[model samples]
Structure formats: structure tokens, C-alpha cells
Target: MATNVKVIAGDPSQGRTKSSPFEHPYALIPTPSLPTDGSKPHGALLNAVEMFLVHNILIRAINSILYHAPLVKLHDDIKDFLHFCEVFVDFTNLHHDSEEEHIFPEWARACGQPDIMNENVAEHTTFHAGLQELRNYAKQTRDDTTRHSSEEVIRIIDSFAPALTTHLRNEIPTVLQMQQYPNGDEQRKIFAKGVEKGAAQADNTTQIPFALGCHDAGFEGGKHRFPSLPWFVIMGVVWWYGGTHKATWRFCLAICIVGQRRRSFEIVVSEHTRR
Candidate 1:
């Protein structure tokens, strides 16, 4: 409704108008209540990105452990998983701060009139509260290396990753449209401004590394076009451990390579060579 932008959240019929009758979802975890005085903050995408990163890293770490399994050797990888978790949690808290400080305020200003966006900000605030609850529980389990990451914490993270993923997927289209303008010059001006702002703030920083770690490589059955990372990191990850580790390495490699259309030409060449 702001120019050509669409707002899709909340209940859908209380005198629905360009002013907005589309109710926004409770959308976001329970978090600290946000102020409604209309100060444009930051974050939103970063929060979603953090969720994506955590999801990928945690799930991959869990799965990687299974690859080294028979229990005994899993001990070492499990230690790695815990260390990773510590770092992952630290990243998430910082990301959340960006949301509370900057991103939500922007949403509030961007959607001030219908204030659906403002309400969305409120929802984001609640999300922080939920995270705080998680933090308390997590702190209690700090020295513990087991899966004591509360079912609530795990459940929220598990649910949030997919939900946040969906939100980001949906929001990106909106961000593009919001940046577009009446003409090329106008569009470029707006984008230039956005780029300037982004350079200073750069919320996506932690996300890029976390996302790359989670997505680009795997043992078996996943998308392969994600790009190979540095060889040393790959070798260190795949080889330093042992045979079971090698299986996981080969498994990831096989899916990446063999999944490539299963070339009929390879079979043909092999048969010709045999003859």
C-alpha cells in the first residue's frame, strides 16, 4: 500500500483498505515489548539470516556427528559441535541486538500509517523476549556439553529457521520493490542510498559465513551448486579425523559429483575402453 508495495500479514477483514485490514501474523518469537514512539530502528533481515545460519550449522553439525558414529568417535565431533554451538549462540545474540536497535525502527517508520509494520515491530520485540527466555536457559546449561539446549530453545530454533526462511524469501521481493522507483535514475538513487546505509551497518556479515558453512558442503543428498570453499578447510574437515570421516567426505563428494545428470557419455566411454 506504500506506493506499489504489498503488506501481507494480520487478520484479513476489519474494513480492509489501502490503510490495511490484512492482519500481520503474531509473527516472531516472544520478545521484549518494543516502544511505539516511532523511532526507525534496524534489523529484521539480519534476524532471519541468523536463524538460517543457526539452522544450517546446527542441523549439519548434528548430521555430521551421525556420520562419525558408533558412539566412541562421535565424542570428538560432539566436542566440536559444542564449541561451534558456543560461537553460534554468540553470533545470534549480536544479530538480535541489531534488530532491537535498528531494523525494527525502520519497519516502524516504513509502515507507520497503517501501522501494520509498526505492529510487526511489536511482534519483533516479543521475539526478543522469547530469545531472552532461551538465553536464561542456555546460560544455565553453559558448562554442560550434552543436548541440554532446552527443548524450547531447540524447538524455537528449529521452528524459527524455517519460519524465518519463509519470511526472508517473502521479504526479499518486498525489499526489491521498495527500492524500485518511477524511472531508472530514481531507482538508482534509492538503491545508492540503501547501499550507503548498508555499508555502514552491514547486518549480513555474520550471516554470510554461517550460511556458507551450513550450506555449501555436505556428506550426501543436497544441492551442489553452492560453491566449493577453500581446499585446506575442506581437507582439514574431511581428512584430519579418520576413515569414518572419509566416508562422510566421499559421501558429500559423490552427491556433489554423481548427482550431476549421471552422464551417459561416461558409461559409453567406459564400455568402449573395455572393448
Candidate 2:
């Protein structure tokens, strides 16, 4: 896949610049992006914050199929379930690789606490092997063209779910707390750099749309967290390159958030609170 970079605007509102004397060493950095009026959960953690929620939604999708697909007696349902697994695995690898290689380092640098994210990085090792095995299984299921054991696949996925979910849940607060970095503009710059790096590594056909599909832009009474390009441009890219490869996205909660409304390829969110 050829590399492409997408530019998105940062939140216009500025946050508090002062550091309190009583504040902890890693005080949360004030940001205009984080909700102040308490209208919604702020998305200003985990480097690419929105991606954090999107990751949870993906894990939920994978877990749902693992638990429920076994009860499905029909062969077609089993097939569809396996297909969803493939999408989940691919999307996860793409996301994780980006985090490990690009995003985490930025957060660590901004925090001046390189060791702060060490545990999160270590947690990735625990599930790395399981993720690889699951991906291999997904591929084998696709290529074998035979009736595969849904029970076995579910067990494989279930084995990894606990660890994966732990990392996902634990990360929310870890990242939310990173707001103590004391420089919102610098933090925003780091975020943009990470997004650009991830975009360059992405496959426009599969990964781009898959990432878009994972985003729940409707969070907090229908608002997005990033800037957007023209609707036609985004739609054009997805339609032209994404092709007929997005079967599993419909099952994602992010897409369901908008109900029957047309999906946006552009990523957008408001950093302001709903006062």
C-alpha cells in the first residue's frame, strides 16, 4: 500500500499553563481538548486518545464473536465470525505496531518520565504471541475452504481476551493522567506526528477504512476529536481503494453509533465541553 498523510486541526481553545506547587510530579497537563464542564469522558490520554476507545471497541467486537459465535449452529454464521476475526487481528496488529513504534515514545518524551509507560509496553509482550497465533489461525480458516471448528477458534480467542482487555482498560487512566505533561501545544504536535507516522504505514484499501470504521465519532452527543477533510475526498479514497473488503466493519459498535446515517471517512472531534 502506498503511503499517504492526512492533516487534521488541533483544538483551538487553550488550556491552563500554570503548574501548581502541590501538584504531583506527573500532573495532568491542562488541555482545551479535555472536557472541562464534565459533559463527557475526555479523550486526551494514550497519545492518540481517540484510538484508545477505538481499540476497546475492536476488542469488544472480537470478544463478542468469540463468546457468541460458538452458540451459532449455522455454518454461515461460523464463516462470518471467522471473517470478523481476520479483520480484528489485522486491525490490532496495525494499531499496536504504531503504538509501540511511534506513539508511546512520544508520550514518554513529553512526560520526561520514560519509565512511566514501561508497564504498558511490557504488557504488550504478554499478548504478542497470542495475537500472532490468532492471526495465523484466522488465515488458515480463510484458506482451508473447509468446515473449521468454531469451538476451537473461540477457545483460542477467549484465551487472549483477558490479557488484551486488561491492557486496554488499564491504559485509559494511564493515558488520561498523561495530561500532566504541562504543554498542550507540544502534546498536540506529538499526536499529529504519531498520526502521520501511522498513516504512512497504513494500507489505504484495508487499514484506512478499517480504522475509520473503528472510530465512534458520535461520542458525547455526536462530536468528533480530530479535524476532517472534505467528505467527498475521504469517501473517494475509501470507495476507490477500500473496495469490497469491509464486511466486518458493520458489526463494529462505532459504526452502529450513527445508526443508519452515512459513515464519515474524515475523523473529527470537539475538544470542548458541552456547557
Q: Candidate 2 local accuracy as lDDT?
A: 0.55
Error of 1 at 158 (Å): 4.8
Worst 10 residues of 2 by lDDT: 14-23
CA lDDT for candidate 1 = 0.33
Residue-by-residue lDDT tens digits, candidate 1, 1-275? 11111123222222122221111121222222223687532243323333333334434433322222222123233343333343344444454445445544454355442342343334334344444544454455445536453344455455444433344234333333332222334333333344345334533323233333334232122222233356455444333322232212221101112122111010000011222
Across 14-118, the per-residue lDDT of candidate 2 in tens digits comes to 111122111122122122255568664423543545655456456545644554454434344445456667777777777777778887787788778888778
State each candidate's clash count: 24, 11
lDDT of each: 0.33, 0.55
Clashes of 1: 24
* TM-score, model 1 to reference: 0.37
Q: Candidate 1: where are CA atoms >4 Å away?
A: 1-83, 86-120, 146-153, 158-163, 183-212, 215-275
**Using Cα atoms with residue i matched to residue i, what is each candidate's TM-score against the true structure?**
0.37, 0.68
